[model samples]
Target: MAELEAQAPTPERGLAVRGLRLAFGDTVVQHDVSFYVAPASIFVIMGVSGCGKSTLLRHIIDLQRSAVGDISFDGQRLVNAEPARRAALQRRIGVLFQSTALWSSMTVGENVALPMQLHTHMRAGEIRDQVAFKLALVGLAGQEQRMPSELSGGMAKRAGLARAIALDPDYLFLDEPSAGLDPITSQRLDALIMRMRDALGLSVIAVSHELPSIFTIADDSIYLDNQSKTAIAHGNPRHLVEHAEDARVRAFLKREPIDEPARATTNEY
Candidate 1:
C-alpha cells in the first residue's frame, strides 16, 4: 500500500535506508532490505541482473515509492519531507545512468552547465568556469564543444560523469558506469573513479554486474542470491572470492567472463 499520501524525509548528511520493500500490484520486488552508506566511502551493490539493486537505489534517491520502510538522512527522515526540502537535498546528490544520459543535441559543456543553471543563482561566466573545471577533472577539458554523438563510448561516459559531478555533489550514484566500454577504457574509468573519490571525498554508490570492476574499486560490496531470496555475502571482493562459504559464491567466483570476445578460455590461476 502506498499510504494515502507521500511524506518527505527530514535532512541529514549521510543516507540510510531502513527495511525498504517495494512491489508492483502483486509481485514483490524487494523484501526488508536495509543498507547504510557512510560519507566519503564507495558503497557498491554487486549482483547479477534483476536483484532489486536499482529499485533500492531509486528509493535512496527518493525517486521510487517503498511499500514499507523509512529512508533517513543523517538524522532527518526523507520519506516525509516536503518538496522544497527534497529538492534541497537532491541538489547535493548526483546520479549517473548506465547510458550516460547525455542529450544528443547538447554539447558536453552545455550538459554539464545544465545542473548549475537549474540549481544555483551563479552567473553564466561562473557556470562556464565550473563546467570547464569539471570537464578537466574528467579528462575532457577542451572537448566540451563535442556533442554526445561525437564521443567514443568511454569519452561519453566520462562526459556524463563530468555532468554528474559538476554540481559538486556530496554523494554520487553510478549505475553500471563501465557497462559497454572496452577493457582498457573500463580500467581507466575505474582509476578515474578512485581519483574522484580521493579528490572530492565523494560517497559513491555503484551498482554493477562487472566482477572485474567490482574487484578494482570495491571497498565493500553486497551480493544478492535470487535463488535463496536473500543477500548471501557482504564484504571485500578479494576476501569473498577467496573465503566465502556459499556454493553460489564459489560458482560465481569460478565463472569466466563471457561477454568479452577478445580472448579465449584459459586456466583460472
Candidate 2:
C-alpha cells in the first residue's frame, strides 16, 4: 500500500469556496456562493430542485468551469490551475454521482478496480486486495462478482461508495447519497459516512435535501437559494432550522412545501 499512500496529499486541510458564480449561456445558476468544509468534517450542499446544488458541486470537482470565483483544496487554487496540477488535485478526491455511475457491464469488483487501473501502477494482485478491502469497509464484502443489475438500491450505493474510496482520497463528494433509499437504508448509509469521517479523517461534501439524512450526518452545510442566486444560509442543518433568520430555510426544514399551488374551491354564498 506504500505506492497508494505515496500519492496522498500532505498536511490535511479543508475545501474553501469563495465568490463562486456559475452560469450556462443565458442562465445563471448560482453567484457569490461561499463556504468552508472543515477537514475531516461532513459538509452538505442542500436546496430545492434546480437550485444549483449540483452545479456548485460540478464546479468544486472541476467538472464544470465556474464563470467567476475561486475554489481551493488544501490551499491549492482549483479554478485555473495548470492541467497537470488539476489532474493531481483530482487524484486526491473522489466523487459519487447521484446515479451511482457504475458500469452495468462490469462486476462490482471490476467497477471498483477501474480507477486504480486507470490512475495507478498498482499490481493486479494489489489492486484486487485493495478492492476487497474497500468493499469490506462498505459492508459489501464477498459480492465482488455481482453485476450492477444484480444489486438492490442500497447495495449499489454501497458498491459505488467503495469504488469512490478505492484510492483512499482525502476528500469525498457525494450527490444525494441517499436518494431513492428507504429510511432504514438511508440511516445506515449515513452511519457509514460518519464512520468514514471519524475513522479515515476524510472530509466529505454531500448534496442532499433529505432532512433526516442531512441532520444525521452533516457537521456543516450551505443552502443555495434559487431566487437569490447564491447561498442564503450556512451552518449545521439543525442549528439553521432552529435559529436561521430566513423564513425559507425554516420552511424547508419544517417540510412545508413553499411553492405548492393553492387548491381551487367553490365558495357557498
Candidate 3:
C-alpha cells in the first residue's frame, strides 16, 4: 500500500473528482463517482447512450452543479468556488460541445476569434493572427472566410475545434467529438487531438462511446453505468478491455454480450 501510494500521480496539478454525485431535481444521474486526470493526459468518459456521460462532462465544466462532492483543478476548488474565482479558473478551460455549436451567422475565422475578442484585450490584429494560427493548426488554414454552413461535417468539426482552442486553454473538454464523422475523418481528428495534446500540453476530458476514438486517444478512462448510477471502472481503455475483472466492463469494451448481472464496483486497473 505504501509503495502504491508513493507511485501514484499527485492530484495537486491536475483535475480531481472526489465522491461526486449528480442529480436533476429529484432524480439522480450518478453517485460516488471519483477519478483523477493527470496533467497532459487524454482521459475519456465512456458508456452507452443515455448513461449520463455528457451530463458528467457538463458537471466537470461547471455547466451543471454536482449534488455532492467536489471537483478541483490544479488544487483549486471548481465546485462551489466564488464566482470570480470560478470564472478565472474557467478561462483556462475550453469546451467543444457535441454539436460543435459554431455560430451560423459568423464566418469560421470570426468564430475562432470570438473568445479572444470577448475575454482578452488583444488588439484586432493580434486576434486575427491568433485565429489564423489556430485554424491552420486544425488543417483549416486559408479558409477563414468560409461560413459554417459551407463546411463539410468533418470540416465543421475542425472549425469548431479551432474555436475551442482559440484561447490556448490548458484543459480541453470535448463532448462526442466524433459523433457524425466518418471513419477516416474520425481517425484524422484523433491524430490531431494527440498532436495538439503534445504541442499544447493540454489535459483533455472527452465524452465518447465510439470504440475507435476511445481506443485511439484515451490514456485513461472511466466507464459510467446508468443502471448503477455510478462509475464501475477506471483505467487505460486498452487494458480494461482484456484485464477488467468486472464482466460488464469487459463486455462493454469488447462489444460482447453482457449476460452477467450488474454489480456496482469501482475497480481501477
Q: After superposition, how far is residue 267 of candidate 1 from its true place, in Å?
A: 33
Tens digit per residue, CA lDDT, model 1, 1-269: 23422243433666676666766667666566656677787888866676677766777887887658777767566777798988877888899998998999999999999999988999999998999899999999898799899999999999999999988998899989999998999999999999999999998989887877888898877776554545778787778887877766656655634332342432110
Model 3 misplacement above 4 A: 1-10, 260-269
When sorted by lDDT, best at the front, the candidate numbers are 3, 2, 1
- Quickly count the clashes in candidate 1: 14
Candidate 3 lDDT, tens digit per residue, 167-213?
88999999999999999999999999999999999999999989999
Q: What is the lDDT of residue 165 in candidate 1?
A: 95
Error of 2 at 162 (Å): 0.4
TM-score of each: 0.87, 0.91, 0.92
Cα RMSDs, all models? 6.6, 8.1, 5.2
Model 1 regions lying over 4 Å from their true place = 1-13, 256-269
Superposed Cα deviation of residue 252, candidate 1 (Å) = 2.2
Identify the leading candidate in terms of lDDT: 3
Better of 1 and 3 by TM-score: 3
Off by over 4 Å in 2: 1-12, 259-269
